[model samples]
Target chain A: MSDVSLKSMDDVYPQSAGGEVRDYFQLLKPRVMSLVVFTSFVGLMLAPGTLHPFLGFVAILAIAVGAGASGALNMWYDADIDGQMQRTAARPIPRGRVSKDEALALGVVLSCFSVLVLGLATNWLAAGLLALTIGFYLFVYTMWLKRRTPQNIVIGGAAGSFPPMIGWAAVTGSVSLESVVLFLIIFLWTPPHFWALALYRCRDYSRVGVPMLPVVKGPDSTRTHILVYSFILVAFSLAPVALGFGGVAYLIMSGLLGAGFLYLAYLVFVHRVGVEADGHAKRLFLFSIFYLFALYLVLLLEAMVPGMMVPTGFEFKV
Target chain B: MEEEDLKKRKKRSIAIGLMLVGFAILFYAITIIRLGGDVFNRPL
Candidate 1:
């Protein structure tokens, strides 16, 4: 028997036959949603004020939905390219499970719903930021910047960075230096993280006609840029410590993790082109995920542990 | 023709089921621990 038959008769079905609900969910990119929710929740928790549990839940729900809306819109716009890339070929729009028009409509509905509900439930500031995030991700990153320039993810990263600030504003109703620091952590982290992937998957992106850095600038330049950004990320990660939001634990974690990131970038920089370079780049890319998650987790832990000696100089009053 | 489609549908269903289970584990931790919640609210 063939592998397809041995695996289960159900494996014979065409990919496009999935229903609307499942396809719609696929557009949300739930893994990305998890990161958005986690970072936003960190922002809310670290904010100076307090929110009722129910209200806090609502705010996070809205933010997550808005993130999902943006993801759907991105999928809709990138379907043409997505279909060509092995990494993205299984996505709803690319797989023909969801129509472009349907994805667009669902995105619009969720965008409005999230923003309005967030504004009404929290404050106008957070709602406005949420709306801006959707617009920036959809219009700026997806439509304008992506096809035009290799620096797309660099500037486009700002959309993803907004969540922490939005979560902060949801409670405080205004942006603060601390929230800005949180935003910077993610913003600065993006280039190195994404460029690492680009270095490994440059061919896939080029095949799909996307102007990612590795495709447009060559892998050598992309590696150098990754090293530069990784250095900057290390500096920015330490800002919370300098700003006094972090305690000893944060300092130690940031120091060790930042060194690890720098080491990976160095390896990627030194690795020979082709397979070895790709392996190093993939290693850095994977480590970058764990690095950001650990960094934020330490921040949250510092906040919860009393007498932990948070850094004590920079406090922004809103 | 219908049989082939049904088979595909079953595969999709199983994939979705596995995804939901993963999400459920994540959501359960997020909702239950209320990891980001402020102090003074112990679970009732």
Candidate 2:
């Protein structure tokens, strides 16, 4: 829409060959799917009630497929920008391995299939949440907000953050404050995590005309934003412990992990320019992923291991 | 190139067939699980 021509596969590559299974699979963005599956599994396990193991597996599978459907839809819509960005240039649509129409069909079919299956297997609440996730991603984030706002990742982050809440709803058939807390953790963590990457890849985003924070507001402001969000994220990561869901292990882990995260963020904030600054930003980006994973891992472990949920002696009334 | 495209299309067909069969099985299993022993209690 922004002067970037949306070329179909035939237009770009007249003799382009058909896609293999691998290329079609790549359209789903499996790496992101894996993380979604893991977090949702953790959320399901940590919920108040228990689900049948087989049904639990089905719920996770449906959620993963739904996430993948959104990813495919996103790729279909962003093919124009995808071709311009170095990071996304090799994606199936851009590479002509898969047609944009094929991606759209796959996405739409999978979205309906996953949602219907989830509704049949579990409650409609979980299925509805899945539907909302797919819709918000495709309609709100991808179509509307991404190119228009520097806060794109900040809002688009909700799509990625919904899996755990959906998993929680699948087990309980209701939304609880605990599930909302899990959502907040990821929502707050998204800005800093993405901004760090945007800092280094600012040129790529600007070239593609995507309004990423670093591209729109410059690196200094983006660094300030990362440090601020990192502060809030670190503080909120300890909320589970206060909420009585996370154990003593989680308390200790969150404390240590928060310190490391804050230190990396501080390094990013302090180093303003040059290769040294980019290195710090990259470190923060990588460490942010590990920090969130470790925090969730500790919570998941506490839920799994019996006798591991010792009280931290301070339960605040929330 | 034509031969390669044909091969890929054939492979895609096989994948789709397998996925459809798998979907049917999964739905059947879910229906059975959700119904549980109550399914056996139904009158003929």
Candidate 3:
């Protein structure tokens, strides 16, 4: 649905009974923001430089704001479709907890505030990446790709992947292959992770006309894609070891976790029956979260204690 | 119900607004204090 349709239906849309502070906070999608914070923090820690404690705090804060802004904008724009979907119907905008105008203002305010503060706290490179992440999410993914094609997550995944790079750039003031490998790890992981959810919730997407992979390509095709993406994800997961950003500990942990991830994807692949498919997808989706977190946690540990694990000597300790 | 809802909304929005203003003030103070008298001289 577009702005015109929304305007036409404005009369039918329920007015918010007015919302609480928590309602507005809900618009930020705090769960997703936490992931953003964690990944970006790991990137900051791994980058071979130190930031002023105050400035470091500001950098993380700004990233959080930018992420929240993206979520607000997404909710604002997707409110209509969101109301139709089971999982998202309770969101602020759709549930009349917050108005579209309020959400839009919140997003714009947070986006500008985060970018400006980040630039002041860090450097132009990190700020620029932050700006791009916000723009890509609001414009490229939410507005354009989401409703149009099944490949939306494939490309839109880049938005989520940028946080770590922004964190890297915040410290090093440049992007390198090391930060990029981190980006690749998440980029490859998104499809399998999201497609698993889509496998279970294809009906929700179809009802909203969002053209998610399972809805557009059918569940079997989506499963195949999930398995293929899982293979790539496992490969990318171990790339940190090969690329020299991860040590033996990282390699061992990632290899073990990657094998587990591949097995879940295989389960998702083999299960064709409805209930069985949903079960596999649920398992895969949950495990994928753990898989990525564990990979990054190992890297963070290696950075904190180089004695524990030595990343491949891809970059020198600057 | 409507009256109570309206009151709750007013209180919530006001609280958030105040919180945001405070956040901004703190941010500005940190930047200004850290940068010292030369804060304005340095380009943001």
Model 2 spans with C-alpha error above 4 angstroms: A1-10, A13-17
Provide TM-scores for the models.
Answer: 0.82, 0.96, 0.92
Give stretches of model 3 more than 4 Å off.
A1-4, A311-318, B1-3, B29-44
Docking class of 1: incorrect
Mind giving the per-residue lDDT tens digits that candidate 2 earns over A189-261?
Answer: 9999999999998989999899999888899899889888988998999889888998789999999999999
- State residue A182's C-alpha deviation in candidate 2, in Å: 0.4
* TM-score of only chain B in every candidate structure: 0.59, 0.82, 0.80
* Model 3, CA-based lDDT: 0.88
TM-score, candidate 3, is 0.92
- The lDDT leader among the candidates is 2
* Arranged by TM-score, best first: 2, 3, 1
Fraction of native Cα-Cα interface contacts (under 8 Å, chains A and B) also present in model 3:
0.56
Could you tell me the lDDT of residue A206 within candidate 2? Answer: 97
Instruction: Supply the TM-score of chain A against the true chain A for every candidate structure.
Output: 0.91, 0.96, 0.95
Best by DockQ: 2
In order, what DockQ does each candidate have?
0.10, 0.82, 0.49
